[model samples]
Target: MSFPENKLTVRSSADLATAVPYLIGFHPADGSIVVIACRDRRIVFAARDDLPAPGTPAHHLRELTAHLIPVVQRQQPITDLMIVGYGTKEHIDPALRVIDDAFTATGLAVRELLRVTESRIFSLTCSNPACCPPQGTPVDPTTSLIAVHATVAGLVARPDRAAVASRFTSVDSTGDVIRHATTEATARKAALETAGSTAVFEAGVHAVRSALRQHDNDTPLTDDEVAWLTVLLTHRPVRDLAVDLTQPHDQHVTFWAEITRRADQALVPAPATVLALTAWRCGDGVLAVMAAERALQVDPNYPLAHLLLQALHAGLPPSAFEQATTSTHPNPSIPNPNTPSEQE
Candidate 1:
């Protein structure tokens, strides 16, 4: 099923008639640009027909190399995407407002983080592979093989967002890296681990609200694991249910109680876990900080702990902590008023 070459504007994909492969040629005054195909049709670039597809390592290399043209040119044209220059780079960077309007109208492009994570309508859509055989529907792969390389790299780069997340082994192997609602479960799991899992039975399941996006209607906790989650988040305030920190401090108590009661009824009660968790959840803030620092001292490899301190200190306003390290210095040239002369 090869797609045919097109010389005219593809106002929409409907204009494209090929199925196997396709070529979209872009001619600029500087050089002829070509986009053989992209994950999305909207992403055209400028370059020669000299690389593998986007999924291949070779193609990525070419993509990086082509950006040099613009740097040589001094000023980037509307279509310029990189300094190396790209094939479809001539299309013109859409204005932020234009892109927003386009998204509002068609809901297609995968450029924005939120856009990358928006809910997907899996049932409403079907890729060629869905009927062909479960090639994981092309969208969802057979296994999500949590690209260890990619994950580790991302974790290292983004300490705050790099969460201790989870995904079904299969999805982690094959699913698209994008965040469609289908991926929300994975993201939420990561938040659960990263947000707070140290406390055993004390329910402070303070996951970032990736939970709300996936199950916004307040769906009942059907899975035993989910019920456990309700139990774990007992330490969180009811106001935090929305992951909103602006709410009053006491809001989460009731939610925590319900969670505790559910967890309390497990066939085999895990009291040890509960007691340890109780200490964690009810512990004072200063104690938490000291414990956190001590944990760092003990084993600096703890991913969340390292990131925690980074976020804690870096996330503060400059003015708030700028002077915390201030120290008074004695002047060597001037004599001390009270005979403290031994300082060298």
Candidate 2:
């Protein structure tokens, strides 16, 4: 989830319950398992997965643990872990027990285990009925402090994960106009190849930026403009240039997502991959996975799509990729202040 840098204090289970939705960028559906890792009282990362069925074997639970464990270990070290399952107590109890045992064997402290239904929260770790009522605490997630703060910060969580996935669906309008445009673009590609690679690459970048700017101001691209741009983008280097020119955050996402829908699917894995990256950066893992699926369906061997698929599978945060991109700068050597010869 894209959250404010300033930390919000979570002093109680109520507070944690309030924060989970914002942390994951959506309200988890029933049968969802959310795992939160924390260090020194601040949440480091949160991951949500679907809980296995009640009658599933032990290996299914182990596979779920395997998925969450790598994410916990990958980004940073944590001192405490919490698990929240969204379902009835009867259905989720077995999964929780398995999770508890897995974490125990891994030597990580399971600080809290909670079950959340539509109306109330049940805390399994807290024995005190006074602090946590035996019947469960009646709380509303929409009115939580974190939810209010998130609204003020302009971070809107989707209602559920499926809603997030719907954003990446391709426009499958196979009408006369779209077919004509695709044919025109294909013919244009042959001429674009003769236009010289450098010129084609530079034009592709300019067109992408212009399209994004127009998109921002609510100006739609003309059919010919879309045709030419789509044709030029088929070249790998030109596509890479367009990827580099995409603006930040949702704007980048919007640009590539529109392109992915409009462009011929068999010819443009670039826009799909860019859409996946932007979605991943925005913490919408559902869209990222769907966008990557679109790309892989177009070209199974596309490296960037495969990389993002692996990343989503491994539960790597977007910041890890950002850090990896910027970590290659050479450090300047510093003179020793304590050198006796230099002091003399």
Candidate 3:
């Protein structure tokens, strides 16, 4: 969902419709409601949620509004917003009304309210039938200039959300390789345990630097290297070091995605969370959510993944995390793994 810092103007509703897929990195699911917040004519934040069911209560719609308003407020100074709902009138109308009212209460204008069916788009706010026909206006992204500009700007609109999630799915047929590497890595860790916590911690720091160099050179880590790194990342200090090293770049995404997919199942949370953080920093919220959800699937109590999910849900920008990280320094204490007090 990343775009250049330069502003891309939307002259008409049709152009906005065409640009949505590119902005979110995928076409939204049917029955979904998308909110795009703008500040002083620049697109700032975007979020999506499912429309309420047919029999849903009025309070349920209120709950939806409750969830969205805070997110919009967190991205404050939002001058206006656009809401697009993909579904039938029965489902979309009520939800749109609740959301629009809620946003307006917060003093932000609703620029456009649109309902998108399979073949056409209907403007709920526009009464004029000439430009926005009563029967709805046809929207063909293939013929859209906005689509052309988005493509030329190197933005990709995946066919659907699932297609974006598939990017982090496990690589095919590497289970046996990872298993054998895990066994060796476990033995090596046991030997290092006898040496002291400092030795294991230093080894992990070295491993992190070496892996970064390998990724920089466009050389994927071997099965053994992935195993050792994932095992060491279980150490909190080591994981923190890895997190500090991650940057907002596609290279970091590729590097961590491979590590996440190749790690043994029990060791997945660390690498997956790192991948989530990296994607968030890159402005790829869809990927960040997918990766964070994957980590929680492996370990529900993983605090870092939970924190990342919270930030994304609150609509906080990546700079929020960058500022926090830069302001705090790493703890200086390092306990020896051989000490009884340090053993978990």
Candidate 4:
């Protein structure tokens, strides 16, 4: 995901290290390699992946390099690249070499290479001991100027990927509630089928809007109400309608997150994909990846989830989706039911 046009001028290796977590939206773990793509020193996108295991064959590096080139190219022409390896000297060296060789082959400039440990950061490109000491320099993110600006902009740097994923976890008390909702939803589905697809779509649209309103008013849905809405949303027309109707933000994110956790995967792919799209639009790449994985698990051929996965992997900025949605469409206030449907 891309940050706002917030100015984060990186004057030193220490400044770069401090900005990595904010750029990627998480504090990376050990053995992770982070690639920050920039155009004229403004970050276009940042991605992180674990260092390939020791003894990984040459072909693996080639495959990774191939994947990265297109991802960077798709967003914008990468004028410069900063590669940061988060591990010990031995582990990071091979990975760095492989990445350097790959990018060089692609004719992309490698602006800098650095290594980050638990307590210090070392600049591989800078030989001047006065600036980048041979041993390393202690890096404190808290005291950095970028950290102060990020806080003012309401940006948060999560602890790790796992911490972000934990937001979608289901609660144990919902077991009986889910089972009851499923039964009710199934019965409603049978009745609606008899009324045909249009009726089903209409009912689903109404139910979805009502549910969102209830969620806004802090009114809890009954188990049966949740079940009916969940099942209705499985239909493609209904699901697409829901997507077209809602806007993305904090409360919408929370609503989809809870609904995704509550919905039975065996019953529908809508909740999972919706959750993925919402997370992606909100620039929570880690959570977006997890939700997309869950949606694919439920229905391997699900096109919406698959498309989102590709975009997420390609490091498409969240602003791309936001702009596309708003430039062509009007405000995201609730849709009028009397109007013609956007999806059949």
Best by TM-score: 3
* TM-score, candidate number 1: 0.16
- Note the residue pairs that clash in candidate 3: none
For 1-344, candidate 4 gives per-residue lDDT tens digits of 22446666777788888888877778998889888888877777777887777678878767877787777777676688889999888888777888887887888888888999887998877899999898899999878887887777666678988766666656546777788779878888889899888778778877888888799999887767777888888777777667766667767777877787777657546887887888777766777888888788879998778877877887777677546545754444435645754543
Model 4 residue 37 CA deviation (Å) reads: 0.9
Question: Rank by lDDT, descending?
Answer: 3, 4, 2, 1
lDDT of 3 by residue, 213-263 (tens): 789998888999999999999887888778776777888998998899889
Q: How far in Å is the alpha carbon of 34 misplaced in model 4?
A: 1.2
Worst 10 residues of 3 by lDDT: 335-344
lDDT of each: 0.26, 0.73, 0.83, 0.77
lDDT of 1 at 17: 14
- Model 1 accuracy (lDDT, Cα): 0.26
For each candidate, what TM-score against the reference? 0.16, 0.83, 0.89, 0.85
Off by over 4 Å in 3: 1-7, 322-329, 332-344
Poorly placed runs, candidate 1 (over 4 Å): 1-248, 253-284, 290-304, 307-344
Q: State which candidate has the highest lDDT.
A: 3
Model 1 lDDT tens row, 262-330: 332221122112211222233211222333443344345643344334423232222232234122222
lDDT of 3 at 188: 94
